[model samples]
Target chain A: MNIIESITKSDKNISDYKSNLQKISLDKLRVNPIPSSKNEIWRQTNKSKFYRFLDFKFNNDFYYPQIPGNTKNHNICRIIIGENKKIKFKEKKWEIKELEEKEIYNFLEQKIIQSDTTQNWSNLLNHFLTDRKNIIGLNISGKEIPSLEIICNSMTNFLNSKTLLVNIEEETSVSISQINIGDKNSALSISTYFNIGKESVVNHGIISFGNNKSHIINTLNVRQHKNSEYILGSLQYEYDFARLEININQVEGNAKTNIKGIQITKNNEQISTYANISFNGPNGFLDQLNKSLANDKSHSVFEGLIIVPQIAQKTDASQLSRNLLLSNYAKIDTKPQLEIVADDVKCMHGATISQLNEDEVFYMRSRGLTLEEASKLQLRSYYQEIISFLPISKERWDLLALLLKDK
Target chain B: MERKKEIKQPLLEIRDLFASTENLTILKGVNIKINPGEIHAIMGRNGCGKSTLSKIIAGHPSYEITSGQIELCGKDIEPLEPEERAQSGIFLGFQYPIEIPGVSNLEFLRVATNARRKFQKKEELDTFEFEELVKEKLDIVKMDSAFLSRSINQGFSGGEKKRNEILQMALLEPKIAILDETDSGLDIDALRIVASGIKKIANKNSGIILITHYQRLLDEIKPDFVHVMADGKIIKTGDSNLALELEKNGYDWTDEFINKK
Candidate 1:
């Protein structure tokens, strides 16, 4: 059966509130066809690869999520999605509680129904496929919160779906690391939402990778209030097909958003990122940098958009997309765009695609480094800019070593 | 009784070297020879193929050798890759050292030093040992330790970059060191420090080639032979007096000398 048919026919034991939303999403998916290359957003996407993502059977069997090894020593508050139905952590400084039904309903009404209109396909698909057991919603509040690590995994030959919602209270500061791992020939669909309260700080990192020929579609939505700050660093690699969609809104302006993300693609893998940020009030600020590295016959894509309306008079935003084409056959598509109706706003966008500098390689080679060593050094240098921005500790995960191992 | 004569093989030798790039001849029938303990200064005008010759010796891939032979310690190195040539004891300090962002200068130095050591079959130094060794070499250039922590040449000034080049030379200790325009961007104080560093690094088992246009550098680091190159060929060979004459007359004198040849 097709993916949509299978999801609709599956036994979905969820609350009435989520069931109603799922029915709406299922009807929407039934009417509208799957997006193809003719669509502007999916223009660079390979349709057959995406069809393959939808070809897997819905996984019903229980499987344990394999947590990364190094998280044990860090005293981090860990949550493994698909392993638990309800999670709660309370400490002296902060508390994490599963969101009540009313809170989820309010989130759907306020954020999802309002801002996410045109590009709601991924969210709709995720909502349709994710049952109550697969959804994790948390309301986090405190001044000195412990670091949080959330992990999501897909089983082999199965299509898994998961959703996460986090609401940070006012004056709270928190750091969260989200890791998504896909098994061989598996597919995963994930939807993540963050609501930052007034005067709060959120440092979030998303590190996602997959085994051979795995696929993933991830969507992230964030809403920031006044005097709040939201910083996101993401890295994705080693998937046959993976796409990340990020939507951030500065609700009342006077907030800060900093995003740095990179996607590395090798062999026949394809990875893409689409980020959109909008300012609703004045004095909103955004600094976004997206990078991609493509090797072998792989493809990488990046598209970033920043919007400043008339009310956002003092909004300042900059978006840059930098890409590295590591092989002659490799390909990269990058576009950084800005839409500003505010007369007094400052907005800039730029994109660059280049190969490793030959002169730099020759310089290293002249210093007794072999060509392979020199290229690896260059790759390490290229990956360092984004890797260093990640919120995770280097000791906890040797990201650079992992990135350079195959190269 | 006739005394026994001692003979030494040349550390570097280039015979009838003809090289080109993209159908343009850069080095045409060029030749130079250097023995141990000798410092050869090649002075020429801009675009006289001075830098081209240095790049060719370092085995830059852009240039194709139509015909020639480059020997390191009497062994032909023409077929070696750039790294292979470097491993075989040849070092070429760049004219404008490439700046690599996000690469630590200390780590780059350590890797390069270890590569040379591995080629020489010497034990590789661990991080602590390498740091100690690098600290000693940093003193030669009078550089601060902070530069080591930064990206390779990334925010370094011109003089610092040149000193970094020299620091690399000091660490690698190649048999033949070809420094191209190492004095171009240095102030007088930096020049004194760098020239003295070169002098310290020079030993009886190695040869140095200083490519420059100024007689000022030649003043600080005396050369055994001064060659004037014009149109890809060394037209005149003399001692320190030749540099003084070049300084006095500029490269205009070399035009007449070339005509005489």
Candidate 2:
């Protein structure tokens, strides 16, 4: 079926849900008409190749995700194309269930209809394309869950999209991990929205391990309430083409946000991270650290923007991007930007691109380590800061370390 | 054992060595021979090529050996790389040990020890044995067990860094140990402790070369021979009293002595 016809038919067939999935995409398409590579947001990233996958048939029938047998989580969400199945082994403090059609419609009408249209065009496009596909809603209230692992997997030539809405109640704490695994020629997109309640704590990690021929895109939109805290740790490795756009808003005063991300790309892989955090209330704080390693002919791009308005007095935000270029042909483009209209704010941004330290290599060599061993040691250290900050336990770090060693 | 080591052969010998860096000569036709069971103290003023000599022996890549021969255990080792030289039993205690951020001290020690063991064709020590060995060596420097998990010398104080260098010396047990200004920037207590550690590690199978400007370190561990270096060459060689003379009268006598020569 054609892209427009398929989406229009799905919109009609939906039972009682006024799915804005196609409306937003159609509206944006009517306004912008076509995706433009000249746009500032897409300047370093090319989306022309994704147009072909855009018209691919959206299939809702596929095999269940093959998660590792040892993967354990109190709440697990598995998505394949448009189908979703959630298995909850324990549900003491929170409820995990499929979002009703009426609930999904009310959410879109209440949240997206009144938002500024020109701000997040890409996110609107993402939502329009993925809203009616598959969704899982989490209602957490004053409980601490060990971890929730969401596995997204697809085979070759498949098209899939999934969404998650996490409504964290006051004073609740939760940890969530999103792992994306895909085969060649798969096109996967995910959108996760977090409504963090007052005085709540949320720790999230996203590990995207896409194959060499797949295209994956993920968008995270988080709105934090007063005195709430959100920490996000992410790593992306071996993606043919991937983009992660994270938009965080401190809707109330005294909120805290921390983000740590590591991206390792080799060969022809291209990975990009765009994070924009806005402090709307007074005393909102943000700390972001993004480290990327690009080897061979790979390309890594990072753009972090922190906006503190005039009302956000006493805001403290720091954003830093540290990138490593291992080979002569590897490329890294990083921009850490700050827009502070508040006079009483402390804001700092820095970007660094460096190769391995020669002196460090010599020092290790003098201690009898070979050149390769010394290089590996530096790489391991480069990721230690991010890995240590991850909400995962210490015993699980060895698994991540072993995965990094393979690269 | 001492007499046998002394009569057998010199542990390290520099024969008419000439080395330079960036087209500027540093060590000009220098000759020095150090035998096992001997402690040779090389005292020199600033820019006298004392550190250069130690680095050249360690095969630092910045310097060029225009004409020189470094023999370790009666074999020419000038052609080997720095790591090869290290595995061949040459260790240089840097005046400033580099701070390797991110690598823990324990992991660094284990990796270095394993590399040396692999080079020697000896069976590698597993984690348990290596941890025990590192714990034993940590006491030699009076270092706490907490330091094993920290990054290597990332935030260590001057005395602590020196002790870590000595700890590596104890772990590697090189045949020719060149302490290049290892006593610099150390407190009195740290100096005594470091000197004592060096004495404990020095044995009949290894030769120690103490490179320092102050005679205070020698007060703790007396050297059998003292050499005064000036203008890229060793000018005067004497007993331990030479260090006291230089400490009392300064290096002016060496200039006059070189002028007369």
Candidate 3:
């Protein structure tokens, strides 16, 4: 109770934006863990030990994660030593800054926040506004962002307090890979707002492997102009628990979005992901796949919802989650749901959980491999399912491979 | 730490072995014996219990050995698990090798070698030493080093997958190797390399049980003992000439021999 209320306490002046956030207290919502006999999300969730643990809203102090045994080789962002620590970006035409409250309000008034309801999770995000005005935002539209690298270097109090937002202008194509690193047990509530112009494309890459209890809640609000495209790659491998909520809406016809993500969980760690995509126009498409491997007592959860409105004709959406449970006790909860009111829309979803085949093991042993070796071999193959589909980068693939598998 | 037992005893012995699946018998009252420094070939048409007999010896759980006595090096081994028998040097080259999509070939090799080595109370190889050890075995199957990093058979061709089986055989160096139809789908190049690799590893301290449907592989490995099997039992036993005759006259000769009996 102390952990989570502390999160909501960061906000004080909520009456100003009460109209934006639904007229319901998030803490008081009748979601899971509440004293309700019926639970929607837990209908299929194996909630024996997790029911009690899920109520843990937010704790003020989570022990600083032991610097991961070896991260000397992880391929994340780099940190510079000086004061004007020049931030590096894979894409140009963007600038970073810790703006004052006035600057933040000015940007908001200019329609820089493209998201509608996805960014409304915090009833009062401005309440915890310390570096609330800090972020790298794009100015001009119709320009292409090669591959932006947003560098986040923290001081001692990095997560004790701070928040930031990244906004992309309309009609611009920007690609960014944010690297978050430093000492504090940082809890970052990140929100992204992207606007798509006619026939424009935006590809965003996220490679997070830093060692810290990073509480990152990402909200992506996208508007698809006619014939526009949006592609996103989400990469996460290290954390006690990383929760990412992605919300997308296709506003016009002939637009599409392809989203792919890979996550690796080990130890007694946990990872939670929520993706809600809706098509509001005709002739829009969504193709998404998310893969994860949870070993030891590590737990993984993925909930994907692809909604096609009644007027959203000719929409195509497909989603799949493939999980490999390395240990008998390790658990993966995957739910791919399609809520469609349009008869002409094509939407499908599936989830599968299986252990390595016994016949395959014997076949490997026949080649002189021991049972343990056979298991390792099968595990390597499981992780390769995602790495093989990665966008052709040898260094990233090698680094991810090492982080994914211990042996 | 590599213990060497006495070589005078039978390397493998299966007596009155009746193996089954779902309580129905597939290997009925079969008996076979193989000693060190010898090569035995089992010839039969499809569905003759050739693969079943090999799986039974390797401890495949699906095929239950209802009533039998199997001895390896003069000790009863029917009760041991598949992994236990592997440590004791019983290898089964499968007809269709399974693809393990997540494991790298090199990691698989090191784990297997170390498991057997651990059984023999030997030290396991470190990464550097393991790399060197794997380099030599790469030549055994004429495979490239690039395969070491790739996932095991995730996207390998049929031929490459089979060659991988041979590569593993050369690396582990088991004492009793059972090649179960290793030549079933290989072209001439793969078949020649696989046959040569098996022959090179066949020394006086080891033995091989070559199970095949045709005499094509017999021409390469040159088996010393040829046994014809039908209806889950070996009907006749002879020298290498039996394989040539069976290749020419086919299984009809076996029917004539059975009628004469």
Candidate 4:
């Protein structure tokens, strides 16, 4: 049987509210089956690897996640989403409360379903596969909210699905770090939604990785109000097959959005990222940079789209994609698309794919560094451009060191 | 006749050197010997193989030595890699230093200094110790302490880049230092500063080679021997007067000399 049929057959009894939403999502998937290689959306995707990802059975039993021992930090509020859901801190400036069923239904119908249901296939797929208990929705508020961290892990030999929804009140400011880990032979699907209120600021980071032969499909949808600022830094590596999709909408314009993301692939892995951003009103701004490094016969792909309608006059947007091909067999594909209907808007997009500079490598070698050491130094330099923009602290995670350890 | 005292070993010796890139030969039948405590200046027009000779000595991979022998203190060093040649005390000061972003200058210097120290059987310095040593050496180029924390040569002015190169030379303390057109882009003050730094780093146990096209730099740092090169070979060797003569009359004089040979 197909993945959708299998998921539908395994559906269990739940509240009428959640079951209704799942039914709608299932109908959508049934109408639009998996896209073939001829489809523009899945043209670069490896068909065999995608089929393998969909072959896993849906996991119904709750499996406890393996949390690393070294992930404790007193300065931030931590939340773990797994078999044992837990929240670690309480502060007076901010609060978190679960979303009611009526609230979830209202959000889906208004924001997601009405926006463009056809384009959000990944979110619909997640909604259809995810159990009612696996969804985590929180309403957060306050001006001085503490930094937040969310840790999500997948179980082995199963297709685990989870969803997160966060609603921020007006004038609230928060920094969030989301970490996702995939276990061996596992498949994970995650859908996240964020609503930024007027005059609010959001700093978000997503760091995800997987073990041997693991797969992940992550989708993020964000809505921003006027005068709001949203900055996102994302990184994905070490997954056998991974896809990240991002959708951002400036609701009333006059908002600022900045995104910096990187994907690293090695050893036959395939990773891809697709980002679509729209400026709905006037004076909206966006600066996006996407980078990928492919090594050891791996493949990396990036597709970015920016839309500026007639109402979004005076909008400013720029998108840049930089790729590094580290081996002769490694492959990188990048496409930047801009659709600007506004006559007075300034929009620019560019893409570049290149190898390391030989002159730079030889310069270091003449300074007493071995060839391997020189290459590693150059790689470190390349990784720093994106790493320095991350909100995490080096003393806490030391991501640069982690990236260079194997090299 | 009284027996002649044994001659001291030359610090660097190049004999019958012939080198080329993929389709063109750049250096042809060149010979030079540099002794301890002596400074040699090679003056030539553009593309006369001055910089190519310096790069060949440092083991640049672009050029192949068709028939040549490079000896360091009487030991053949033609087979050593660039880093090994550096660890064996050969330094090349580039005319245009590359700008490397995101790599700390101090960290690079520490690693390079320690690499040479390890080859010389000396214990490597930790971060703290290396910082102290580097600060002491910074005075040789009169560079500010702020540049140490920045990326190597990224956004540095031309003079600052040259000074940084000299600071590296001081830290590495190579036996044979080849400064290739170090005064090309410098103003009078920067040239004076760079020349002073080079003079300070020169010692009795080390030799210096300056490749240039003008006599202004030679005025600051005097050379014991000045060699005029044309068509990939040294056509004339004389005292410091040759540099003054070339400065007065352009490279046109070298054509007559080459034709006579």
- Candidate 2 wrong stretches, greater than 4 Å: A1-20, A47-60, A72-83, A86-91, A110-119, A131-133, A393-399, B1-5, B253-261
DockQ, 0 to 1 scale, candidate 3: 0.39
DockQ of each: 0.85, 0.76, 0.39, 0.76
Q: How close is candidate 1 to the true structure, as a TM-score?
A: 0.96
Q: Rate the local accuracy (lDDT) of all candidates.
A: 0.88, 0.81, 0.66, 0.86
Interface CA RMSD, all predictions = 0.6, 0.9, 2.6, 0.8
Pairs clashing in candidate 4? none
Docking class of 3: acceptable
Cα RMSD (angstroms) for every candidate in the order listed: 3.0, 3.3, 6.9, 3.1
Candidate 2 lDDT for residue A321: 98
Task: State the DockQ, from 0 to 1, for candidate 4.
Answer: 0.76
lDDT of 1 by residue, A1-407 (tens): 46845544534532433566566566566545365466557888877888899888876355777765475578688888777756888989889899998778667545444433347678878876777677788999997777898988899989998889999999999999999998888999999999999999999999997889999999999999999999999999889999999999999999999999999999999999999899999999999999999999999999888989899999989999999888999989998899889999889999999988999999999999999998888888888888888888887887888889877
| Candidate number of the best DockQ | 1
Identify the candidate with maximal lDDT: 1
Compared with the true structure, what per-residue lDDT tens digits does model 3 show for residues B1-261? 122334577888889888899977888788988878789999988887899999988888788888878899888988887888888888888787776666776777787778777777889898789999889888888889999898767688767877887777776777788888999898888889988888777877788899998888988888879999987788889999999988888887666654676
Candidate 1 differs from the real structure by a C-alpha RMSD in angstroms, to one decimal, of: 3.0
Output the lDDT of residue A243, model 1: 95
**lDDT value, candidate 2, whole model:** 0.81
The C-alpha stretches of model 4 lying farther than 4 A from their native spots are A7-18, A84-89, A109-112, A115-118, B1-7, B259-261
Winner on lDDT between 3 and 4 is 4
* Order of the predicted models by TM-score, top scorer first: 1, 4, 2, 3
> Chain B, TM-score, each prediction?
0.96, 0.96, 0.93, 0.96
Cα deviation of A205, candidate 4, in Å: 0.7
